[model samples]
Target: MTTTVVGVDGSPDSDLAVEWAAADAARRHRPLHIVHAYLSPFVAAQVAVPTSGGFEPVLRAAAEGTLGAAVARASSVAAGLDITTDMPAGEAPAALLDAARRAALLVVGCGHAAMAGLLPGSVSRAAVHHAACSVAVVK
Candidate 1:
């Protein structure tokens, strides 16, 4: 079955989006897929560091923690809900879009437009404009 996919970034807005996506998945009888993409400065700079140490470990740990928190939040919203998670290492918007390739809905969090600006964050804006399925921008 097509899933309901949500992108998380360890922000309160993302937590809210996780909750919303979980509930929506339950209501629609679809699995919930959570994505947390880690953009590494090392990769962007084309600097290869040993996997044993440096930014790689730190970023992976942080990404795992974020995904774990999101899973707990989602479970709290919908007990026994079928859920899966992906921690893709790349740009947030691209990772989220790829993860939602077969999704029925793509959910993302955005800061308050008034506070951040008149426009939603780049990731959310990209998802809304480019996602193949319906997009939900939860503030």
Candidate 2:
């Protein structure tokens, strides 16, 4: 069955998004797809100099680890919730939106748009505007 996708980045609003997504998935009787994409600082740190050794391997590992942790976190909140995780090698918003395209719902933290919870970044906004399915920004 089609599932719901939620993006997590270890923030308060992301936690709320996870809970909300879990409930929504339960209500819909569909699996929940929790996604988390992570990259190393040496890959593309804004304030730090990029490493010269390359970053593809480190980035892939970090993304895998982040996605695994996100799944574990979701399971801790709602055990046996049938959540499948995806860790794509890309920006969080882009990967999330990609997952959302196949999802019944896309959940993320509320961006600081004076509409809902104040997320500290613009990733949520990008996902909300570009998501192919219903977007829910949990407060």
Candidate 3:
């Protein structure tokens, strides 16, 4: 079945997006897929340090928490909604675009409008232009 894909990052904007996506999914009787892309500090640093004890676990935990919370919120917003979460390791836009490939709609949130000549945020703009499905930017 076609799904509604949303990108969440534990931000207020992301929360709004999740709610909007959930409502859309409910209206359309579709499943909702929430994704959060996390970049490991080690990978971001591009340096191979001792893996004995690092912040990787903390980062992963935080990402998991974010996804969980987002799922909860979506579930509450739309009872019986088939909601799922994915924590991909990479850039947000890339991860979102990948999820959108099989989605019927992709939803994202924007805090504010961009400059006259520019799009809102990189993720939203990129998804709007590259996603395989229609994209919605909730303000």
Question: How do the residues 16-126 of candidate 2 rate in per-residue lDDT, one tens digit apiece?
Answer: 788888877877888999887655232354434233345556656666765676777777767778988876644677778889889889999764422112235577778
Pairs of residues at least 3 apart in sequence or in different chains that clash in candidate 2: none
| CA lDDT, every model vs. true structure | 0.84, 0.72, 0.82
Each model's TM-score?
A: 0.87, 0.74, 0.86
When sorted by lDDT, best at the front, the candidate numbers are: 1, 3, 2
Q: Number of clashes in every candidate structure?
A: 0, 0, 0
Task: Quote the RMSD, in angstroms, for model 1.
Answer: 4.0
> Which prediction has more favorable TM-score, 1 or 2?
1
How many Å off is the CA of 25 in candidate 3? 0.1
Model 1 Cα displacement at 136 (Å)? 0.3
Report the lDDT tens digits of candidate 1 across residue range 66-132. 8999999999999999999998877777888898788999999985322222244877988988999
Which portions of model 2 show Cα errors greater than 4 Å? 40-65, 111-119
